[model samples]
Each structure stands twice: as structure tokens, then as C-alpha cells.
Target: MNIRLRSAVAGDYDAVNAIIREGQDEHAEALPDRFARLDQVVAMGWYRSFSKQPNKEIIVAECGDKLVGVAMLEMKQSPSFEALVPRTYAYLNELAVASTHQRQGIGKKLYTASLAWARERGASSLELNVWEFNERAQQFYASVGMRTLHRMLFTDLT
Candidate 1:
């Protein structure tokens, strides 16, 4: 696929939100109720503020006039750690490739673009989160050189 990657604009919000929902559905296995309660619009409304924030961008992948993927990136310093100094890094808050467009390298293209942007902006590292239930996503990230920094575990008490 001939993919064009660029920063998102307000006009791309609905398409971008749909792409995000694709990811949410994939992870719904881990938190079905939580995902169910997310009024899609409210969950995606953060874009209004993210669009205004400095050092933040939402990238959209276009394939012949259609957006097939979207990724959100934020550059910020690591939260203060009493024993260590904070370092700036890029956080990949979200990355979603449309279900029909998977395996065509759209995700990788979006990721590479985000990485280059981070590097150009002086971020020391790039980080992201993947739910344990989404093993495919974890493996994909690993294939792109991302490793397990830590695991977040949980159990149902209900």
C-alpha cells in the first residue's frame, strides 16, 4: 500500500476515532465492561485538547484518500522519581490500524513516523502500553524493537 503519514487535523477526528475504537474492541477481552461504558465520543473528545498541547501530535496514515491508521504521541519528561532525575521521552498513547488494513504495514509506517518525530524532537526514548490480552500487539511491538519495561497485573475482585 502506498501510505502517506501526516499530523492529524480537526477534520480527521471521526475517522481517527473509528480507528481508535477498533483498538478498544480488540482489548475489550480484558475489560469488556469498561470498554462498553466508553461513550465513543467522550473517549475521543481528548483530541480537542491534545491538538492544542505543545509537543503532542496525532498522526494519521492515509492510503489513497482514506485513513487506514492513527497514532497519538506525547513528548514529556518522566514523572519525578525520588532517586533519579527525570528524562524526556515520547509516549505512544495510541496506535490503531483498521481491521481490514492489517498486515499491510500500515501500523509499522505509522510507528516509524512517530519514532522519527520523537527523535527529531529530542526525546531520549519512546514508550507505549499494550494490554496483556492483546498478545498480537505485544509481539508486533517487540518485532519493532520495543521490549517489556514492566508488567501491569490485575485480578477481578467482583
Candidate 2:
């Protein structure tokens, strides 16, 4: 397929949201209910605010006029989880390619664009969370030189 990579615009939100919803469904099916609540959270407007944040960006890969992949980035000073926190970082909130487009390099292209955006802004590190069982994603991240830094655990308070 002929794919074009570009920065996202406000007009792209619907397509971006569709990709997110589909990705989240697959993600939810593989995880516990606690984390699955993200589908609802995103649907209720959380992700809508992401692109508006000063430090956040969303990129899309399009085949003709159709969006085939997306990557979302959040750049910020490293939070002081401890008093001795390190340098600035970019958080990769989401990176997804349409299931039909897997293995076509859309995800990688989107990731490359995101990394350039982060590096241009002086971020020292780029971080993201991938489910432990997502071996394909793990391999992709590893291929692009992302190392596992931490494991996130979730609990349901509801």
C-alpha cells in the first residue's frame, strides 16, 4: 500500500479515535478489567485532551485519505518520583497500526517521527509501556533500541 506519514491535525481526530478504539478493544481483551477501563476513559474525552496539551503530539500514517496507524507522544520533565530524578523524557502514550496493516512498517515510521519530535525538543529519553505478553511489540521496541525500564501494575478500586 502507498502510505504517507505526517503530523496529525484536528481534522484527523475521528480517524485517530477509531484506531484507538480498535486497539483498546484488543488490549482490553488481553488484560484484566482494571486496565480495560481505559476504553471508557478514552471514549469519555481523555484522549481528546492529549493532542491539546503543550507537550503532547499525535502523528498519523495515512494510505491515501485513510489513517492506517498512529503514535501519541507526551513530552515532559521527568517527574520526581524520588528527589534524584533524571533528565527530561517523552512518554509514548500509544503506538498502534491497523491490524490489516501490520508488518508494513507503518508503526515504525510513526515511531520514528515521534522520536524526532522528542529529540528536537531536548528530551533525553523516550519511554512507553507495553503489556508483558505483547511479544511482538516487545520485539519491535527492542529492534528500535528501547529497553525495558519498569513494569506497571494495576488494581481495580471500583
Candidate 3:
């Protein structure tokens, strides 16, 4: 497969959004209550903002002119709560491979490209979050050599 990896352009909005929606569907399967299907408007708004961010990048994996995967990255500086230094890092905000093309290494290629982009931009680390119940995603992240830096727990008080 002659899959091409490149930065997302304006015309890629719909394809990228579709991939993310597929991701949301996967997440919703894990938590039907908390991860309900997102409205296209909301998803599009978020994607538009991410796309326009000066320090953010939306990368796409396309095969024969069809977008098969997408990964969004942002350059961020974390608050120095543990130390006196503010550390710059790369935040992986979103990543998804087309349902039809998953497990074919498209996701891996997107991740590898994003990592290289982050490193080239002088980021000290790369970080991303996956819901606790998404075992598949957790495994994927771990397989890519990412260790959990923290955990977030929530409880319903109603």
C-alpha cells in the first residue's frame, strides 16, 4: 500500500472528522454513559480549533488519496507543580485509524510520525490519555512504549 503521510490541509476536515467519530464510537462502546455519541457540530468545532492552533498539528495518513488515519498533536508547557521548571511537551490530543484499515499499522505510522514531529519541535516528552475501560487502546498505548504518568478517577455524587 502506497500510504502517504502528511500534514492535514483545510480540505481534509471531513475525512479527519469521520475518523475521529469512529474513535468516539469505540470509546462509547466502553462507556455508554459517559462517552455518548458526539454531535458532528461539536466534533467539527473542536477539530477546527485544533487545526487553527498555531502550535498544533493535525497529521493524516492517506492511501491512494483516501484518508485512512489521523493524529493531532499540540505543543504544551505543563505547570511546574513538582519542580521549579516548566517543561515543554507534546500532547497527543487525538488519534484514530479508519475502522476498515485498523490493525494494518496505519495507526502506528501516524504515531511514529507524530513522535518525530514532536521531537523535532524540541518537546521534552509526549503524552496522551485513554479511558480506563478502553483496554484495547490502553494496550496499544503501552505497546508504543508509553507509561502511565497519572490516573484520573471519577465518581457520581448525584
Candidate 3 lDDT tens digits, 34-120: 787865612666767766887899999999979999999999998869765888999998888998998988988999998998999
The alpha-carbon lDDT assigned to residue 29 of candidate 3 equals 79
User: What tens-digit string does per-residue lDDT give for candidate 1 at 41-92?
Assistant: 3245689767898789999999999999998999988779898688999999
The local lDDT score (0 to 100) that residue 69 gets in candidate 3 is 93
> What is candidate 2's TM-score against the reference?
0.84
| Steric clashes per prediction | 0, 0, 0
List TM-scores for all candidates, in order: 0.91, 0.84, 0.90
The model with the greatest TM-score is 1
Off by over 4 Å in 3: 39-45, 80-84
The 0-to-1 C-alpha lDDT of every candidate, in the order given, reads 0.85, 0.80, 0.86
Q: What are the runs in model 1 whose C-alpha is more than 4 Å off? A: 37-44
Instruction: Write one digit per residue (lDDT tens) for candidate 2, span 47-66.
Output: 56666677888788999878
Q: Alpha-carbon error at 26 in model 1, in Å?
A: 1.9
Cα deviation in Å at residue 74, candidate 3?
Answer: 0.4
